[model samples]
Target: MELKIDESIIKAYGFTHQNINIQQIGSGHINGTYLLTKLPSNEKFVLQYINTNVFTNPKAIANNIQAVASFLNQQFPTYLFPAPLLTVNGENMATYNGSYWRLSPFVDDTVALDTLSSPKQAYEAAKQFGKLSRLLNGFDSNKLQATIIGFHDLVLRFEQFENALANANTAFKTKAAEEIEAAINYQYILNNYLEIKDVLPDRVMHHDTKISNVLLDQNSYEGVCVIDLDTLMPGKFISDLGDMMRTYLCEFSENETDFSKINIREDYFAAMIEGYLYEMGSILTKKEKEAILFSGKYIIYMQALRFLSDYLNGSVYYPIHYPTQNLDRAKNQLKLLQELVDNEEKLQDIINQSLLKVI
Candidate 1:
């Protein structure tokens, strides 16, 4: 597919490369991403068009990245973060044709895997994410802007699900009766968030902690950097850990039709716990440590609710491939949630054992 590139937007970045080529890359759901390569120099960069509809303030997104990058550079100079390139006018982002755009130097010799191919990969990814949280622990999270307000608020998500169910069309209501009941059966999960909100420390969270967001070294298979900084904001530690569990532990993607393929991998779960706790265990309080295992259940149930809500509301939020895609995704998540619930004791054991090793 040919992506339309605004040459003026590229020139605004004031690149000295004479020959440039641009092509769309990645399967990102939120923003439009492209690879811009300079021919003679062979230099490459990633240019992204921010999804303004989801993020009302594009400049705020840039500001958050800039702040986080600066902090990481100063504190953990060895860590690699894709710092946003400044435009000719010294702006981190530019508005062209009513769209927001930003650029960053591409890290070569690395790949972003969509799934965990090995337990080592899982450990590396988790360690990198946990390291990011630990490194930024001292940074004031209030300085960052909430790109999407109420993004990880489970209470708000539950309310939206209830509202969608009440007003759903008859066909949807009839077809999704089982899923709706399953969602409501897990209302206690949202209740847990409300009960613990007071104690859960609000830290700088990488709200989107999917495996794909962590770039892995092509040769060593170690995690190099955590990409996709658009969702960086102040949030509960569970939000980051839960998101990792949601995406990393599952053997199948959220949209899988085969229920049998949706089981959580215990080995991967152990790796995640061991790796995350290795970096973050020292900083986490006793309460936070106790709550770590439950983060998976919290995020999975919330995601199921979000998917079912979108399905009931005529699939407005997430893009759907088929008419029943959202419904299938909801079912997949619910199945994963059930697995987590069944293995809750085992997961807690892993967490406990992992923490003990760190001690």
Candidate 2:
């Protein structure tokens, strides 16, 4: 965690660390994040050096944030956007020591959770992400760069799985036989996506909707605003909501090995669907609404494919603790996908009821 933050970098922004106390914050793996506080004035700003390896074009990120912040300010003046503070040279990002850096004022009295404790937290997070897309409904998605290309495209993933299955070693493939069958059987999910993708409108999406990505009021637990804008890009609406469904509906994560503990929480699903549709229902067309209910399946199946494919490729993409850990994770996501499928009728009923009130 040792960061040699040059004194000149702080001074370039017309601030001095001598008057400010710096402390490391956030558990993000991609960037080096810190909170800089001026004690006497009681002002706090979040500072970070962009991880150039993962995000090759740092200025594209800066430009996208600036554009989104400008839109939020002009359209929804009250919304909180953690827009990057411009350098003295009027640039959104500053290059120093061969890395890009930016600063933004910290929103006081807000906290982010790495896990969900209640269904209400699920609702609040989903609502905030949905509201952001609703607000940016008019923004041109083509203007934003794809930070990671085909990050959520099931078509590419399906091919990746097929290639891995075809070329996988015989013994490892046999070891993962059950999970491999499940992956092949789940090809229908990819077909379902292909059928609906053309009609599902691409929007200005969060691209990553983990609960940790939203800052909530510390006391009320209501959402304050969304954070972690590195993944902001042009993507289908399902990428965000489906990600929420994948991560929030189940109590345990994909790492859990106990299959019995992987059941979907109906109440959490209801809250998330209600919250997201409450904001996005009117904006979505009939085809999109009919198609979006299976978002959980879409995400879970794709993730299972990724894990299974990685396992077939000798455990390359994801680090494996034991030999079959990736296979176990694939099984975990598949079991959860089955739970969603089994309760599909009930969940569809919930979606129908939510649409009645929101649309």
RMSD of each: 1.4, 1.8
Kindly report which residue stretches of model 2 are placed more than 4 angstroms away from their true locations once superposed.
Answer: 320-323
> How far out, in Å, is residue 259 in model 2?
1.8
Those runs of model 1 whose alpha carbons end farther than 4 Å from true positions after fitting are 16-18
lDDT of 2 at 119: 93
Candidate 1: give the clashing pairs.
none
lDDT score for residue 213 of model 2: 91
* Candidate 2 lDDT, 1-359, residue by residue in tens: 45878887787677787788889998776789989998689799998989887788888888888888998899999988888898887878777778888988899999999899999999999999999999999898888887777888999999999999999999988999988888888889998899888888888998889988999999999989999898898888888988998899889988999999999899999999988988898898888788776777888899999999999999986867898899999999999999989989999998899999975
Name the 10 consecutive residues with the lowest summed lDDT in model 1. 1-10
Q: What lDDT does each candidate get?
A: 0.89, 0.88
TM-score of each: 0.97, 0.94
Task: Tell how far residue 33 is off in model 2, in angstroms.
Answer: 2.2
